[model samples]
Every structure is written in structure tokens, then in C-alpha cells.
Target: MHDTGDAETTVILDNGGHNIKLGVVGAEGPRLIPNSIVKAKHEKKRVFVGHEQADCSEKFSLFYVRPIERGYVVNWDTQEQIWEKSFSKFDIEPTTSRIAYTDNNYLIPALPDVSNEIFFDKFGFQEVHKASASGFVADHAYKIRRERCACVVDSGFSWTTIACFVDGVLIQESVIRIDVGGKALTNKLKDWISYRQLNVSEETHVINECKEDVCFVAMDFEKSMIEAKKRFDENMIEKRYIMPDFQTSFRGQVKGIREPLASDAPSIVLGVERFAIPEILFNPSDIDIDQCGVAEAVVESITQSPEDLRAALSENIIVIGGSSCFPGYRDRLLQDVRSMLPAEFDVKVSENVANPETHAWQCAEKLLEYPAQVAWINRKEWDERGDSLEYSRFFRTTVTSDELKATTQEFEQKGEKSPKNGEEEEF
Candidate 1:
């Protein structure tokens, strides 16, 4: 590959399960494109990737082959196609630019090797740097003056992960994963709707939209349930969601709470399901998943950190991801966490209020502003070292959970104050 020298730009790709957030560093922001390579029944001969899926005139019977599964890129063939389309569509030259790719925090061991091979061997990129998505968010939070130490609750499509970062370095052992996410919530909503009102199991896309438009985390679960049972005309809890007729409207939209009109098409009344669907994040037992909820997971993760940093982690909690975009999610999470902690701990849960969908990507863009040459491995270096190259060298800034704990213990034994606060605190 030809080197573009210093003129070559940096590219940031937050490859998410639902959407691919791609943009050049120093650009305004990342552009979100559907990550699925789809084949529609109407046009079986053609395959669509990225924004190409939008051109499909027929909206019904669309089949999607998502490259990402359970927060990992499982299918490189489809992923490569999506990447190629994104590069071409965005006028980006992959071969000449430096690439920073965001992978899931609990990345599978083999995937990184595959990613390196693809970017270095097949795509012929000048350089590649891989980092956890949460790391970028932590760096972004620190850069934006949120806090140096933060607990990130990334509730994405496949899984909800709680990870702690001190000074932008991830605490490996403090990471917690809950298998509940937006996709599971969407599927639960579909199952409930199919069992009660209509069979929407086949209409995953429309049901997902309904969940996004109407679903919320209820602050008062029992009260919400009581309110859901009341008549729609008398109760404020019930709302009607009119399903779209794909022939005319390409996508379904929420029409708000209203009296049923004589000419109104097929519609479903969404009652407690609106809040209950998202409540699964807090109570996984609702779906038979024997795991702690997002808030509990956060507390659990923070507890695994050094004792002195727990208060700071609680105060600087950063909630991001598509699932976190739900109304009252942050408030509910704050309430839950606050109730579990002591009164002295200042609990502050903050979301990326400006742009929830591109939070990680925005963080990545900010991270690119710094000189991260040491974090990157060029094609020449990888080719020379081959299998002998230490992959851990790329993430030299990160610290394992055990390392963090051990260092903190040593400091405590030495009677020295924590790194952030040199002065010791009275118990």
C-alpha cells in the first residue's frame, strides 16, 4: 500500500450491532448507517448494505443479515461489504488513512486477530488501533470535564456492560456484563404483543420502532401496573400505536393517545408494556435471565474497584448506548443506585444528553485529538513481527482489575492517600 504521509487523515469506526458509526477524525461527527446487509423479498437478485437498504421501495418482507451478533462481528464477509460501502459512500480512502476501530469491551479472543488480519492484510490500511468502545467514552467524559474516574454503563443492542475507568484506563476485573439489551427488550415486546393483541413476531423492525417510540422505564412499577389496567378513555397510561401499512407508509409511527376513530386502521393499545419492557434491564428475572440489572451491575462493578474510588465512580457514572436513550432510564438508574449506596456517597448518573446514539463515536473523535502513535501498529510492524508481536502492547495504557486492586492495597498498607486525593480521608 502507498503511504499518504502526514496528509493521510484518521478514520474512527464505532462498529455497533445495530448501526455502524463511521467518520473521519476532526470531522463534525460520525455518520450512522445500518450495519445489516439485507436482501428483500421484492428484490432477491440484489444485496443491500449501509444506506443502500434505504433505497428499497418495498418495505415489507425484508430479511437482514447482520454482521454483528452479541456485540461481536461474527461475519467478516458481510462486515467487509458494509465497510466497503461505507468507505465508498463517505468518500473515504481506507488504504491511505489511519483507522481506529472500537470493539466490545469483553471482546472474544480470536476476533481481534481476525480484525487485525482484515484491516492489515486484506484492506491494506496504513495503521490500525483497536480499543474498547467504553474506553473511548471514558476518555470523552474526561476530556469534556465530566470526571477523571467514571463508571460506564453501556446498554447497547446485545448486552449491557458496566465498566470502570480511572484516568481513561479501563479496570478489566471491574467489568460486568448483563445479557439483557435493546434487542432482547424488543423481542420481549414482540412476544407480549403477539400473545395479547396481535402476532407481531414476524414484524421485528416495526415492533422495534414501537419500542423506541413508546417504551420507557417506569419509576413506579406497581403504580404503572395499576394505571395500565384502567380504561384507555379514562387512564393516562394507555396509548394507541397505529401500525403502518407498508404499502403507503414505509415505517410505522406513534400517533399519540386518542379516541379510536371510525376509519382508523389496525392499532394496538400499549399499556404497562411500555415501561415494563425496559424494566427488564433492572429485573432480568422477568425474562428468566438470572442476572443483576443494569443498576445493580454498576454497583457490583464499582465494588470490585479500589475502595477509595467507589465514591468517585458513583458520582461520575456515565450511561450511554441506544437502550439508555429511553425516557426516565437515567433517573430510574440513579434512584436504584442511590438507594443501594450509603448516604455519604454522592451518586450522580449522567447520560450523553446531546447525542445518545453516537456517544461512543463522539468520544472516539475526541480521543483522536491526542497523539496516540504508540497505541497504533502499522502494517510494516505487524508484517515483520507476525505472530510474535505482542497484542497487549497495543493497549499499554489499560490496567487489569487485579493490578488496580493490588496497587491500591499496597498504597493502603503504606498509609498513603489515593492518587487522586493525596490527603487521607477520615473513616
Candidate 2:
């Protein structure tokens, strides 16, 4: 950990599929901006980015084109547009500030090249460091109490991943990814609502809002399902969500169960959909995906690590990201993980109650208080070495793409099939 006192300013960017959390490193908190460029059905000519999207007159039927897909930045042009807005709106001078950006661990193979092109060649930043957001969270844990071993369950918009960190370094072999996330949950809810009440397949923006406002993980799945099946009037599970007029409210509001009225605007009665959507994270097989759930993924990921570190990892499980904000999620995950583990080994799961979605950004800010010159590359160094600069200096993972490829090939040749559709398998 080299001292970075010479750097005048530091900027932290916790880029996610749904929202981009960014601000000056030392600021009290980070500002969350929409990570996509959106186009509303009512407003065709005007494109909304970041906070501008919130100002759209009609949020319903809004179509979004995001730079990130499946947690990886695939479209640089759109990503650049979003970044430009964020930087300008935040009054950040890229060339003068040291930038720290978060990338998904699975995308590390391509991130270095893309990151170099963007921050160094394009924006001309003074210095840049790229690391997984989970790595930063783990580092923050180590910073506060010197906790070295932990498992991170990051349930974001595009995917939910389980990663293990030992001594602030991520163990690549102990990483597992489940394709179920907020977007999938939203889509599932949309399908359920469309099948039962209204056709909302195209109303992604509205459906997503509904999910955030009402969805929760069920502590007891069977009992919740029983309650969901009761009559709307007698059922405690049912809640009426008043659809936004768009002309006035611009966003829908969740109302208590009520009788239909002529004056009442369009609405949907939400019941099982609330817990059913999030249930996919606990049981991916419900949606026909063969991958294990978050708790199972955590267990599988920890099994890949050294025997001595397993207990520490299980005892320090940290859940983060927007999806983790759902009510009962933390408790339910803890229950499931606990049931799967031996009674002798204590299992503890924790989440940031105040700002779980931006925990990574908060951790990144805390990380800046320590020495970090070794973790960042300056413009002079970038210009001299180009892509030859070792990414391990900035990234915590030491595993190479080629090495992983060879390992996968060896597994395949040995008649063991790799997980399909990029789903992670237990090592």
C-alpha cells in the first residue's frame, strides 16, 4: 500500500447495470445516476440520461438502451454518453483527478483493455485503478476490523455472484455466478402480471418500479404461497398498486387493498408476485435455470477455497447491491445458508442497512484513506508502458484468462461438462 498523498483529488465510480454510483472520493456519500440512456414512448426526440430520465413526463412504456448487458459494458458509445453526463453533472475534471472504477470479476478479461482505452486514452485521467466492486467491499472490511476472509454475495440488476476474498485479494477459483438478478425478477413479475391482469411486457420501467416498491423474499415460502391463494378481500398478502397517471404523478404508488372505483386510475393487485419474483434467487429451478441459488452458490464458492478459510468465509458473508435491499432478503438468505451448514460452524450474514446498493462505492471511498499509489496507474506510466502494465497491481485477482481457459478445457476433455450459459459450477 503506497501513499497517494500527492494526488490532489480522487473519484470513485461503482458502475452497475441499473445505476452508476459515483462522486468525489472524500464526499459524504455517492450520487446514484441511471446507467442507461432511455427513450420514452411519449418523448421520442429527447433522450434521457442519468437524473434526466426521472424527469421524463411519461415513464411508462419507456425503452432503455444500456451500455451494460449481463453486468458487462458491451456498448462503449452508450457508456461514454452516460459517463460524460455523470462527469459533467458532478463537475469532475478527469485529467486532474485519480479515478477508481469497478468492474465485474467475470468481465476482467476484457475490462483492462476497455478501461485503458476509456480512462487513459479517451478521458486522459491523471491516474486510474480498476477493481471489482466486491473486492473493495472486502477491503473495507479488512480496513475497519482487519477481517481478512469473507464471502461476498452481490445481487445486482444483471446477475447475482458469490465471490471469496482472502486478505483483501479475491480468490478467482472461488467465484460463482447465478444469472438470476433484479432484471430477471422484474421480467418474471411482468410476465405474471400480464398473465393474470394486464399486459405489461413492454412496461419494463413501470414493472421495475413495482418490484422495488413491494417485492420481498419469503421467510416461509409455503405459508406465503398459501396466503397468496386466498380471496383478494380476505388475503393479507394482496396489495393494490395504483398505476401512475403519467400526466400527473409520473410514477405509480402502492396503495392498500381497496375496492375498485370509477375515479380510481388503472391498478394491479399484487400478491404472490411480490415474493415469487425474489424466490428465483433462492430457487433458480423455478424458472428452468439449472444454476444453484444464492445461498447454495455461496456454499459452493466457499468449498472451492482452502479448508482453513471456509469457516471464516461463512462467518463473514456480506450481501450487497440493489437486490439485497428487498425486505426479508438478508434474513431469508441467512436462514438458508445456516440450514445448509453444519450446526457447529457459526454462520453470519450481514448487509448495510442504510445504503446496501452503494456499499461498494462507500467502501471505495474508505479505501482511499489508505495508501494506494501501488493500486493505481498514472497517465505518464500508462503512456510509457501502454497495455503492458500489469493489471494485477490494480486488480486483486491474480488468475489469468488463459489459465482459466486451459482449466476449463481440461475439465471438458475429462468428460466433465462446464456450466452452461456462463453459470458457475462448484469446484
Q: Give lDDT: candidate 1, residue 311.
A: 76
Give each prediction's root-mean-square deviation over alpha carbons: 4.6, 7.7
Pairs that clash in candidate 1: none
- Shift of residue 287 alpha carbon in model 1, Å: 0.8
Kindly report the root-mean-square deviation of model 2 from the true structure over all alpha carbons: 7.7
89 Cα displacement, candidate 2 (Å):
1.2
- Which residue pairs show collisions in model 2? none
Write the residue-wise lDDT of candidate 2 on 1-427 in tens digits.
5334356778888989999999996677889899998888788899999768878877878888988888888888888889988899889988778888886543356653476668877787777887787888887776554666778989999998888876677777888889988999999999999999999999998889889998889999999999989875778888888878877676788777865444468889898888888899999999999999998998888788655567667888889989988999999999999998877667888544357798888778777755363377777777787666745466567373343444345444765321112321110
Please give me the total number of clashing residue pairs in predicted model 2.
0
Candidate 1 lDDT over 308-382, as tens digits, reads 677778888888889998999999999999999878888988644466678888777766766353367777777
- Worst lDDT window (10 residues) for model 2? 418-427
| Poorly placed runs, candidate 1 (over 4 Å) | 1-7, 110-112, 143-146, 260-264, 371-374, 386-390, 396-402, 405-427
Q: Candidate 1, residue 414: CA error in Å?
A: 14
